[model samples]
Target: MTSARRWASVAAMLFALLLAATVIPDGQVFACTPTRVWDGDGPIWCREGMHVRLAGIAAREMDGSCRPGQPCPEASALAARDALVNLLGGAQGRTSTGHILVDGPTMRCLSTGNARGNRTGAWCAAPSFGDLSCAMIRTGTVLRWDRYAHGRCRSR
Candidate 1:
C-alpha cells in the first residue's frame, strides 16, 4: 500500500479506538434501577441502568443563571418535585440507591437522597420560582451515573 494511504488507515483506526474508549472502557459499570419515572425536567430516570451524562448537566448549571447561594426558584422546585413524584408513584418510599446526573449546585439534593419531596419542602435546595431556566434533564433516559467510584454514585 502507498505510504500516504497507510497513514490515513492508521489515523482512522486511532479515531475509532478513541471513540470506543469514551463510550465504554475497562472499568466498573453500574446498572441503574428507576423505581420511579417522570417526564418532567431534571435527570432522566430508568427502570434499570447507570447514568452517564453528569458532566453535561453540571456544565449547564454552571453556565446558567443559578448561583451557589441561590437555590433553584420555587416554581422550578415544584416542577422538579412533581416530576419526581410522578416518577415515584406507587414505588417504595425509600429513595432508590443509584447515581443521578445533577447540576453541581443542585448536587446537595442527590447527596442527601431525601425522599421528602422538593428541596425547599425537604432538606435539599429549593428550585427557582417562575424561572424556567431551571436545570432540565430528559426523563426516562439512562446514563452512567458514577464514573470514578466503581459503579457507586459519586458524592458532590
Candidate 2:
C-alpha cells in the first residue's frame, strides 16, 4: 500500500473505533441466514447466488479497501459492512434467529424512478435491518452503484 493509503487506513480505523465506542455497542446480533448468498462488495449478492447491479446498492470489497476520490477510508468501508451486519442482526437476516420478517425487498429509494421491478435485482430485509442498500448508503461502506446500475450493467 502506498504511504498515503496506509496513513488513510490508520486514520480511518481510529475514526471507526471512535464511532464504535459511541454508535456501535457490543450487544449487536449477527446471525444472518440468507436463503442464497452474494459476495461482499460493489453490488448486492442475493442468496440465490446471483449478482445484481442494483442502483444505490453496494458493499465494500471484503479486502476493506478504499475507492478513488471517495472520502470514506478503507477501515470505514469494513466498518460500514460491520455496521450493516449489526443492523441485520446477522450477515444476512435474522429470520432463523427471529429478528427480520424476510418477506419483501430491502428498503430502496431513488430520487427519479421506481425500482423497475425484477430487472434491478433482489435483496432481503428484516424490520431491524431495513434495506441493505440503504444501510450501505447510511454507513458509507459500499460504492454508489447508481452510475453502474442505472446504465447498462445487465442483471446477472
Candidate 3:
C-alpha cells in the first residue's frame, strides 16, 4: 500500500508539470506562418487570415502617395511593396509560411520585442533576418510606430 501511494503521488506531480507547460506561453518568440501579405499597414494573412499589424512599424498602401513634404516619386507605395517582397525573398515562398514570427495584436503575445520597454511594441522576426520592422525602417520602406519607437528610425 505504501509503494502504491508513492507512485500515485509521483504521477500527480508529473501531471501538474505537464499542465503548467501547456498553459504557460512562450515569452520570447511570437511566431507564425503567413499565406498572404497586405500592401498597406504591413499586415499579413496568417493564422487563418488574422489581421497582424507588423508589431512596431507602419507602411503606406501600394497606391497611396508619399507622406506630405516627403519628396518621392509617383507610386512609391508600390515600390515599397516590391521592396518588401524582395526583402522576404519573393513573398510567396518566404512570407507564405514558416518564416513569420509575430508577437503582438495578431498573436496575443503579451511579451514581445521591446514590449517590456513599450507596452504597445510587439515584434516580428524571420529565421534569417533579425527584426522585420527595423529592417523596413533601415530600407526606407516603413517608419517606426512613433509612439513606441521614440526616435529610433531615420530615413535611408
TM-score for each of the candidates: 0.23, 0.37, 0.50
Q: In model 2, which residue pairs have backbone atoms overlapping below 3 Å?
A: 30-90, 31-90, 32-90, 32-91, 32-92, 36-47, 36-48, 37-47, 107-131
| Model 1 local distance difference test score | 0.31
Per-residue CA lDDT of model 1 for 22-131, tens digit only, reads 32122333333333322223333433222222221211132233435323332343344344444333234434543232322122222222212221111112233111
lDDT of 3 by residue, 110-154 (tens): 223322211223355665555666766667766666665545444
* Ranking of all candidate structures by their TM-score, best first: 3, 2, 1
lDDT of the candidates, in the order given: 0.31, 0.42, 0.49
Cα misplacement distance, residue 83 of candidate 3 (Å): 1.9
Candidate 1 ranges with C-alpha deviation above 4 Å: 1-33, 36-40, 52-79, 87-91, 96-156
- List where candidate 2 sits over 4 angstroms from the true fold: 1-54, 66-75, 91-126, 148-156
Per-residue alpha-carbon lDDT of candidate 2 for residues 4-30, written as tens digits (9 for 90 to 100): 999999999997655323211122222
Best by TM-score: 3
